[model samples]
Target: MKKSKRAITPEDLTKIEVLSEPQFTKDGTSYTFVSTKINENNEYEANIHLQQLHEEKSTPWTYGKYNNSNLSFSPDGRQVVFQSNRSGTPQLWIMHTNGGEARQLTTFKHGASNPHWSPDGKYIIFTASLHEDDDVASQKELSKEEKQQLTEAKSQEPLVVSTLKYKSDAEGFHDDKKTQLVSYSLEGNTFTQLTKGDYHHLFQDISPNGKQILFTANLSDNADYELTNDLYLLDLHSNEIKKLNERSGYHQRAVFSPSGEKIACLGHEYDYAGATLTELYIFDLQSGERLCISNEWDLQLGDYIIGDMRLGASENGPVWSKDGEKIFFIATDRGSTGLYQVDLESNLEILHKNDSHVFGFSYHKETDKFIIGISSPTNPGDFYLFERGSELRQLTTTNKEFLQEVFIATPEELEVTTEDDWKIQGWLLKPYGFEEGKKYPFVLEIHGGPHMSYGQSFFHEMQLLAAKGYVVLYTNPRGSHGYGQEFVNACRSDYGGKDYEDLMAAVDYALDNYSFIDEDRLGVTGGSYGGFMTNWIVGHTNRFKAAVTQRSISNWLSFYGVSDIGYFFTKWELGHNLMEDPKKLWDFSPLKYAENIETPLLILHGEKDFRCPIEQGEQLFITLKHLRKEVEFVRFPDANHELSRSGNPKLRIARLEHICRWFEKYL
Candidate 1:
């Protein structure tokens, strides 16, 4: 039997298309979203538009030299407010719903984001961290005693602390840094601080009556607010605050039902024995009764545990129908994040099923329609409008034009069964100009989180690799989310064991099935956990010709003492402290296997990254260099762990280009 081949051409990689962020109005007949149209001047301009149903197009809202999305429509659908970086940092901007004179509402140096219009449409509230204390110099004033207290709290084992959902990345063991809840009145530019405190407030939801504010914070009685956070309510009238959940476990994503009598949210209040899987729960405000919403209690959901608010995972954060009869949300128990509707009267039922996952959504009360944002492993981010018995309409496609203009090869979804009979999901983006019988270089791209999933989304770096003529294969291994809880926790206390086998199996599957992939030209790359795996792969085998490790963990022992989440992450994932099991941590360190690495390697890191920290990368690079092996290191200054996402846009492009350049040079 002969083998079949897959190939593509350079001409297929440059067909760019244009689209916008889809925002539907209350009437359901019209929708609006942000779009960047390529002008004759060869630059992009941000525009807003309203398109009527069944119409090809209707209206365009034009501003100058900038692009914006994350639109929030008023309750009456008369005004829209969104965040824009047009003035440099992101600030809140407002424009009439029908499109008129656009006005800037916020003018802060540090910028403002996540603007949410009050239910009554009288004011707008959002998260702002622009105070002078966020500055580096101001933060350097912590006295020795304060520093000792912070360090001691962080090092304390089984430490007693208040709050439910605790421990944010980089914040360490103190809750001194806070995100202010600022509200801007529509009539006047006056901004008021609703709830003043020295704790973080995120994912705020106003009560149906607009008389109270519900949000998640870590401001319990404890001075060591570095622990978990819980949901709280602030009465706009009496100015009294009340705690909602009584459990010691993590509780977040709280929202009031349309009737205002009950609150629905998602939480993991019980201990999974240090596992990262969180399920959905609903709490009744009046009676203090709580119920688990999702039947898939063990199913892992969302991307990262940091701010894993259920708002994006669920159809709408405990959103109620206009009549308050049902709730809609996205569930991952079925293997993919599909939108599901739960009836308060009946059992939860699947409403809309798609291969892609749902992220964010907004409801239009007047028309009973909902706007949803969806993403898949193959597709980037796209918006869709879903109404009962109506065909789903794609509202905005921000990258379709760019993707088309680049005309890179689309990934082919692939699934492989592991040694344990675990069916793993993956995709392969074949190289451009590929020919069936001819072999080409292959790059095995790994994802971070160890708990994250690589779904269908337009990734610039991966696409650029395909454009540069290399087959890129990325997969969700054993510990990745989207799979149920057991699968997510599969890597717990066994980091480099089964997970490594899963990745190796994926590489083997690609090599065996793809006739055009050259085994001698194999390469590997990843960030965070992916970076750790990349390090692991090079140490364990010389099959790969080249490797790139970004923000990876080289030594678990050092990582525990250094990383912001080092204390909790190591203990939770490895089930051991350095003192309790130093050998276990060292045995898993990629630097421990430096002698086995025969491949050329590149080390990439962000100087300001506090998560994995740059030292981890330094350890690996130094080890490889001291051994007189092929190694190079690149660091981006003023960059953090999120250098790839939400980092400086220009630098992100540079990072992508540099990685491809490295692969082109060595692979």
Candidate 2:
């Protein structure tokens, strides 16, 4: 090992600064972004920073232990409004551009978020969750003692369930509180509730003329069974609501043009359910016509590059040119994301495309420049200044000091041909402190989101494993995004079929090509869908000496009713529901092959993970123990499905240490 460099440790996450939510002022003279860091208390503290185009370093505009984000500049660019949790919940707060103490703007019981300024800057458009009986201005935050008393009283009351979607992993249990739009007037200092009822009005954008508002929600009579998020436009003057689409598809991320004459949309018709590729669309208000702008494009719109360092970075999606002739957006293509522009005639051209993850982007036509956030295998993330013709100059090096002290691994792209003649893409990292010729242990990592791809983004877990002397391998198999639409939908209804072969083929190709890989000492691990794959791998073969499955699914029968989205997700992905084809789901379940599992298995799960409940790990543990097989189980309290990505800082460290300890013991 070199004298100046040290291997990365789990605590290095505290030193890493996660930068996201990039935005430019109207004049393009200055920009603002959020930088998040883990404090000594093991909690996330994010603050907004401002920097001019020629400035060397950014100045912190806000500071505290509270989480601050969702910043928006007023029409005059003299004031900025943002949402903060300083008052125990997220509420709108505004401060002058010159910098001073920020003033709290809202005290609603449930708080306000996603603040946006109207064109005239008279009112700020935001959303807040409210029950039908709660008044927007009168229902305020309760005292600590009152909250405790209310909690005690409500604990004894039965949670009455009537809706099909009664719970969420984020919110825990069902309540009457639904998201609604409220306009806070800066001059009048009054709260005006724009929409209300049992549904949610997801605020998308306010018209450039300040007369209209665009949002999406399902107001259908049978909304319990409907999955559509139909686009709607609300006239602020008349308070009238109008639906834009025929209510056939799930549409969102809609924005109005600079002229306020039309709107751009990103959505899909649920052809492959959630696995369907997102297409772009345009709506003309003058002609009352709609056009699909990206009908011929096979790529998925928006950023899909998976990473762990992102925290509420603003991505300006479907931005129209100042003249309203073209729209700019980001798309994932072949394991990388890039910026692209499309005209009204469907002619598209790439503005920036490369082998890097463009996690966040902003465009300024006034100055013909853009600010983009890029990350690679070795870098965490940093913002860049890019003019149309000038070179992409680095603007911020948030991880410069951290990188100087720690060694970051650079992944080599792996190409493997599957059994079906299909190509699989992956990356391989060499173990730290390498010699000229030495065989080393290898560990394969599978990413969550059977739909989310493993791409050119920074992953702290993989880097830690490589630093600990194990060659790490991660891949994007079938059913992963960033490939074309058909490629992403290939693994549906055949979960353990071709996808398993693709992974095994990739491993075999890796072993054959890399002489430094020790064939006898192989370990495997994955989370969520990757967790299911890990379980399936152990049951199907004894090749891997050790295996770790995290937040996995053991039996689809129980998952069909237990998971938050299990009812429809099972049928959509597996082509079967609980009652219709229990046999098929059972056949594909890894628990069915428990008797064949010879590898030492480690099951890791979170107690609060509603998406993949802890019962999954329990089922596998009991089945394996009953069969006299080697097994272990680890359950994290109060952690959810996102435990690995955004869980409590201490628990995230513990999780990583457990993975390293297990692999070190066996591999």
Candidate 3:
């Protein structure tokens, strides 16, 4: 008899290693990627791993406690370059492909990251922070006393606010430091500042001929007031820069074609604000013409779905085919992200179709094969090798041991019909060791992003709830991606309207169909927009016995001025600024309905969360307490909005414990 798997525990999260940043060598015979694992000290440890196509196992290329990422293979396939924080600040490092002592490259004072190799492998381009007063033209290092003065100046307490975006969630208070493109030459072991500006410049790609570099920056005089990124091309020889596109939109992650004739990128206009689907665009470097090739395709490009687990990859690329005739990327459709390909003739095709999420992928033209990182509810992300006419083969099994020891609940797909005749897609996770006749408590989990989707990706929080004997139900409501753009935009001007109904309809559909669920013992929770919905749901109805809101928004009126993106996000998401329509903002705020909330609620927030700001949660908690309502507030120190996902591991585990305890006490 086979042994049954054990239920998953919160600590299991620490044991699972996340793999990402897969890069294929020029020969296409081997590949490299990054693996990040949490240590006993509750810190993330990252390293690079290499795997040959014919080999059965992958070997670690770099071993240490320091963080390392952004791996890129050299054109000659003899060496690899990546960014590391071993020296207390991120810097570029290069190592032989065959594995040997690594050599540190650049040692910039402000730090350097996102290393991109020139096509010839003679030079490396990266982004480094530069102060406004720093002279880039001089190319001189700061004196010891000057460095001390700069440090003391930064250590001052009071902040002199000048720009509208003076604070950021990832980077706390804004400084005079602006990220600019810089280059390092391997032959001379010298550094040169490529671009000079007060605004931040993000390096995108290097042209095939190595004569130009592609990057994006908000060069507008009112950059603090505008949230726009326009693509620019920099000539390497003359240092001349020119704008590529004249349209008003946010363009990012652009890459040069293999032939260096065209550039492909992911972007969108502010037609629907934050809820607008990201479209793929192709720009002709010669004619300076740009066209949205995916305009006809309604699905959103790239992945926006967020989960508690530490996801390794960001949105996959717009990689051009070796012939430069086709561009490949990922698209979120109906809750799953799939690989897609588009040709110059506007021919769109689904290269890889599945119900699971493809977090990252790389295609090597020499072999005409693809290496993909995929994850599902039952499987944590792993690398797989795929070819056009062959079966997919799992290349790396980083989480195989964890899967063998834990019983990950596989969610059952559900289709819910709302009163507005919209079909809402969702999933349900039955409690571990479920009994056919027993009535198990249920929890309705909502995802944030109102723009993101709740898909087939592995979610640690939902799995933990299932392991603790709760039927967890989560859905992609109307405002979510994967559906058509029309559906995603449905909840923009109308918050807590059809979107709330879509969530409620999901719960109703589950209770009516699932026989093992205990409708009376119900719980609800979500974060960010989902947290906002949880607050809204409790105020609107007492159906839920318990609720937990994390990093949520309670008052749009206050959120407009406090949040990092508040000023414009309020106008973008709610379609109203405080000055334009304060009444509408007040009407949509969940704190306004605090008096009606009867369900026991737990408010969890991170102190340093500038995105939603801890004030949002504090306001809601105070209002409910003054009303003598059932509420509890839990605050985490030195943590940001990403506490649940990338915060301190100990705090993340504690958050899970808090949620489980809150639900257990009330339900």
Candidate 4:
């Protein structure tokens, strides 16, 4: 008899290592990345790791309690620059490739981040938050005492807001601080403010010749009312600025061509509002001609795939090949993310495709290879080396030991046809050590971003649910990204119409196909949009024995006024503003149909969640109680909308435990 492996526990998350942000050297001989894990203090601990193409082992370049990330290699590849919070605030730090003590570079009051090396490697460009009253001239003239007084005056707790977009979920209450572009010269050991204004400037990339820098900013007089971010170019020497794209749209991550003749960017015209698929575009520097390169590629460019992992990962670059004839980027398709290549001739191809999530990837032009960070149903995430014809080699074994000691369940890929003839993609995770004849309770999980898709990524919560002897099912409904524009836009205005049908169709397909699932023992749960759906499901049907809703929305009427992105999100998704049509908003609200709900409900919300807000949960809980329905509300102190993914480690574990306990009591 063989020793049985133990089921994965919530505590096992602390041992899981997540690797991302791969940066390759100019020569493509070596690369560096960040490896992050939860520390004993219940905080994320990230360090830089380096590996050579010819070597089989990877070594840690930096280690400490403080988080270090955004690794970038200097042009010469002799020094590495990264952002670290070891100094109490995030600042730029430089270390040798050979390994030694890292030297601190910037000591600004507000700190610096997003460091970009100039082509010549003589200067480092970065963005820093500066007070509204502070500027290069004012800072130089101010005495030490005056600076201290100004800092104290700005620190007062009172938040005076006059703009509609005054608060954000990530930054909290908006202050006077504005993010501005600045450059630091290594030769002179001096700093120069590049762009300044009341607007926020996001650094994109440096031109190949290093003569101009490309960035994006609103720069409009009434930025609060506008929903566009225009691309701009600034002359490094003359300080002259020029707008690259004249169209009114949101443009970001623009990279100049190797020859400095054109630029490629990721953005959309916003014709579909928030549900619009991101398209790729190329702009000619000389002729000022803009072409939508990916207009025909129905797929959404960049990563919108979601999992239970910590915030998944940020989007990678729209990197250009050395020859400038082709550009390589990431695209979310069906249930997976893949690397795609496109040419000027409108030719597009998927360079690498897998039934897994490619969260982050880097292309090494010189070596014609790739350093990709990927995750699947069983694997958390690791770095892999890929070439044209050679076999893909695993670069880092960050979680190999822990995986060998635990039992990991693999999800079975599924495809269900809806009553409307639309195909829905999904996955089913069987309980660990699943016996043939034993029927198990099933839980249907829904993803948050009604726009984001559930894919081939490792989800701790789903796996944990399966470990507790429940089969877990999740799917990409009509509005999911991996499909196409029509499928993604199908849910708009119809909220619970076809999208609801697609989810129910998925459940029907699962019950008919998977014999191990018990029909009577079914539960449903979700957060954000999924949370809204969970509420809708209970109100419309009694098939589910129990349901858990996390950071969800119950009322669109209140959501438009309370949520962070409510003002625009409600109109974008519901296709109706509160004042324009209150009846339409009320009809789509889940709270309006709460009287019909019969399934026991558990509501989980973060007190500090600005996106969905705790009020959404409160309204639902109060309504259910008024109707004498079985319901419970769990509120997490000091947590936000990201509580489940990137909240306090203890709180995340507690939330998971609560979900499991609630389902066990009913299912």
TM-score of each: 0.83, 0.98, 0.97, 0.96
lDDT of 3 by residue, 131-222 (tens): 86664434433556877897798788677898889899999988889999988888987878898878999999999999999999999888
lDDT of 3 at 245: 79
- Computed on alpha carbons, the lDDT of every model, listed in order, comes to 0.71, 0.89, 0.88, 0.88
* Over 4 Å off, model 1: 1-22, 35-49, 58-62, 65-70, 85-90, 106-112, 130-177, 186-190, 221-227, 273-275, 296-298, 301-316, 333-336, 375-379, 396-404
Q: What is the lDDT of residue 628 in candidate 1?
A: 93
Error of 2 at 548 (Å): 0.8
lDDT of 2 by residue, 1-667 (tens): 4536799998887888999888998799889999998998999998999988898899999998979999999988999999999888789999999778999999988789999999999999999999898888786876668778888999999999999999878778878889999999988899999998899889999999899999999998899887889999999999999999974889988999989999999998898997999999899999989999888989989888776666665684898888899999999988898889999999999888779988888888787788999988889889999877778989998899889988888899988988778989999998888655899999999887799988898999989999999888998899999889898999899888899998998889889999999999999999999999999999999999989899999888899999998998899889999899999999989999999999999899999999998999999999999888988899999999988888898988988888888998888
Best by TM-score: 2
Ranking by TM-score: 2, 3, 4, 1
Distance (Å) between predicted and true CA of 298, model 3? 1.1
Global Cα lDDT for candidate 1: 0.71
Better of 1 and 2 by TM-score: 2
Taking the tens digit of each residue's C-alpha lDDT, what string does model 4 give over 373-421? Answer: 8888899888888898877888887788999998888899999988779
Candidate 3's clash total is 0
